[model samples]
Target: MAESKPKFLILGGLGFIGRNLVKHLIDQNAASKIRVADKAIPETAFLSDHFMQYIQHPSVERIQCNLSNPMQCTRAFKDDHFDYVVNLAAETKYGQDDTVYKQHIFDLAVNVGRNVEEHKPLKFIHVSTAQIYDADKKPAKETSKVKPWTKLALYHKQAEDELKKMSIPLIIIRPAIVYGPADTSGLTPRFICAAVYKHLGEKMKFLWSADLKMHTVHVRDVCGAILHLCLRGNPGEVYNLADKTDTDQGKINDFLGILFRIETGFVGSAMSTMAKLNMKSTVEGVNDKHCQPWSEMCKAASITNTPLSPFLPQELLYNTPLSVDGTKIEGTGFVYQHPMMTPVLVKEVVDGYILQGMFPQPKDYPRPTPIPPPSFETK
Candidate 1:
C-alpha cells in the first residue's frame, strides 16, 4: 500500500514570505496539497506575475478570508485536517500605534491558535521576529533577554506568550531582517533604491553609528528553516533565523557603493546624537529632498506610494546591535543556500524591481535574464 500525501495549511499565504514559502514547497514536492488563507485577493493585491501563477496552481486551494475574526478563522479551518499549520499572518508594519499592533498581531495569533488547537495539526509553526530581543552589543541567543525595543516587538512577545498558553504543539521562529527577490518591505531593497537615487541627484543624508548591527536572512533560508522545524523541531522550542554574516549598516553601504559605484556616508555618532535631539526638523529637511525622486520613481513604475524620506524616526532607530545566533537551526543540519548577502543577491533584488517595472534601469546596466518559475516535481 502507498502512503498518503501530506497536507499543509498556510495562513496569510499572499504575503511576501508566505508566497515565497508556497513556491519553495511546490518546487520541493514537499506537500501533496496546500491551502492558502488570506484577506488579499489576487486580482487586486498587485502581485507580480511570478506569484500570480503560483496562486493559481492546481494542487493549491486559495481561501479568501480574514484570519483576525474568530468566526472567520473557525470557518477556514473547521473541515480541514492538516499535517502542518504555518501562521505567517501578522500586522508587520513597524511604526504603527499600540492599538493596531494588539488587534492585528496579538489578536490574530490567538484566533489562529484556538482554531489550530481544536483541529490538532501535527505541527504548528508561528513566525515571530528577532526584534523581541533587547539591544545589546553581542549576538543574541535563543535564551537571550527579551526586552522589546519597539511596540511592534512587544506585541510579538505578547503573541508568543498567548500561543504558549494554548494547547497546540507550537514551534516559534524568530527571523531577522528577511530580504530577497520580490521583497519590498525589508531594508535591502530600500537601501538599494537609496543608493541608486542618492547617486543620481538627491542629497538625502541620514545619520547612524557605523557599528550598528543589522542581522539578516534570505527569504529562501527562512522558508527552509520553517520546513525543517515543522518536520524535526522540538515542540515549545524557539529558534532565531539569521545568516552566517554579522552585517552592519556601514558594510551594507560599502556593498551598495561597490555595486553602483556610489559613495554613501553617515554622520558620526556625536553628530547623530545632536540630530536626534532635533529629529523633527532634521527628518523633515531630509524628507523634503528625498521624497521628490522617490515619489517620481514610484509614479513612473506605477507602484504604490512610498514615504519620501528614507530616515526612520529616532524611536524606531533602535541602534542597539542585533547580532543574532543561528546555531540552533544550523545544528539541525540545515544549511543556507545563500548564507550571506552577496553582490549577486543584491543585483537580483535590484533587477527584480526593474523586471516588475518598479524601477528604471540605467542606460548601460545589463539586465539579467528573468528567473523562470520552478518546475513542479511528481512524487
Candidate 2:
C-alpha cells in the first residue's frame, strides 16, 4: 500500500537549509504540501521559481511572521494543520557573541518546541551541530558528554531535551562543518580560496595543528536524513549525522596546500607569528576575509582585534573527531547516500552560495571541478 504523504511546515523556510530542502521536496514528493515561513522575506531570488512551482499544487503556503509569538503559532496551526515541522532556523556560526543568538537562535528553537507540544507534530526534526561535542573525547558519539561552549550549542541541547521531555516526536541531528551549495558560512569558501592560490602557484597559508581532526557532512545529506526521520525515526531520540571520512586539519589543510600549491601551517607553529596571538583565531580571521570584497576584506583585516578565548584544549571548534551513530535512524531504514565527503557535492553547494552572493565566497580561487566519489576515508 502506498503511504499517505504528510503535510510539512518549514518554519524558517527561506534560509539556507530550508530553501535547499524545499527544492528537494519539490523535485521528489510532488503531492506533499509544504508551507515555508520566515520572518525575513528572502532578498535574493534564490527560491522564486522553485517556490512558485511548489505553491501551484494548492497545498503549499508561505507565511511571513514572527513565529516566536504564540498567537502567530496558533494561527499557523489553525490555518495549515501541518503534520510535520522541520526546523532549519538557527544562528549557526561560532564567533558571533550572545546578542544575535538569544534573539533568533534560541528563540526559534523554543518556539518550535512550543508549537510541537501544542500541535503534537507527527515529527519534529531539529537541525543541530557537532561543534558542541567534547573534542577532548575522540570518536564523539550520541552518548558523548555534551559540554556545549557557544550559545548555539547550549540552545541546541536545551531545545532537544525540552522536546524529548515533553514527549513530542523529535530527532536531533548533529552535523559536522556542514557545507555544500549556498553556504555563506566560510568553510568551503576558504577551501576555494586555497584552491585558487594553489592553482595560481601562490603559497596559501595554513593554520591550526594539522593533527587536529574535524568531521563534516554535505547539506543535502542532512535534508535526506530529515526526510528519512520524518518517515521512520523514533520519537524522543537523537542522531548524529556525520560523513564517513574522519577529517583532520592536517589531511584537508595539507590537501589544500597541495591542491593550491601554497604554504599550509600555523603562522606561529612552524612559522611563528608575533606575540599576543594564537594560530586558530589568526588563521580563521585571515580565511574569513576571503568572503569579503577586496577593499572590505583588507579593511576588516586591518582593525579586527585578537579574540581572548585561550586555545586551552577546548572542545569548542578545533576538534573534529566525530562518529555519526545513525543506528536508531538507520534502524528505521535510513542510509546516507553520500556517507563520506564528495568534493564535487561540496563544490556545488559552495557555488550555489556564491551565485546567491552569500558571504564567504572568497574570490581567491575559482570553483574547482566537482569532486567525484572516494572523497570519504574510513580511518
- Among the numbered candidates, top TM-score falls to 1
Q: How does each model score on TM-score?
A: 0.92, 0.76
**How well is each residue in 8-77 modelled by candidate 2, as lDDT tens digits?**
8887777767776776676566326788877766544254333334433455577776776656755555
Candidate 2, residue 246: the lDDT equals 71
**lDDT score of model 1?**
0.77
Task: Give per-residue CA lDDT, model 1, range 1-379, as digits (tens).
Answer: 1127678899988887899888888777788788999888877665677877777777688888888888888767867699899999898676688888998899999999998888999899999999899888688999999998878889999999999998999999998888887666676445545644554654324477667888889999999988888888888889998898787777777766656655567777787887778877776665555556666656665767332234454455544677798778888788888888887787787777677665655434556559786575322
TM-score: model 2 vs. ground truth: 0.76
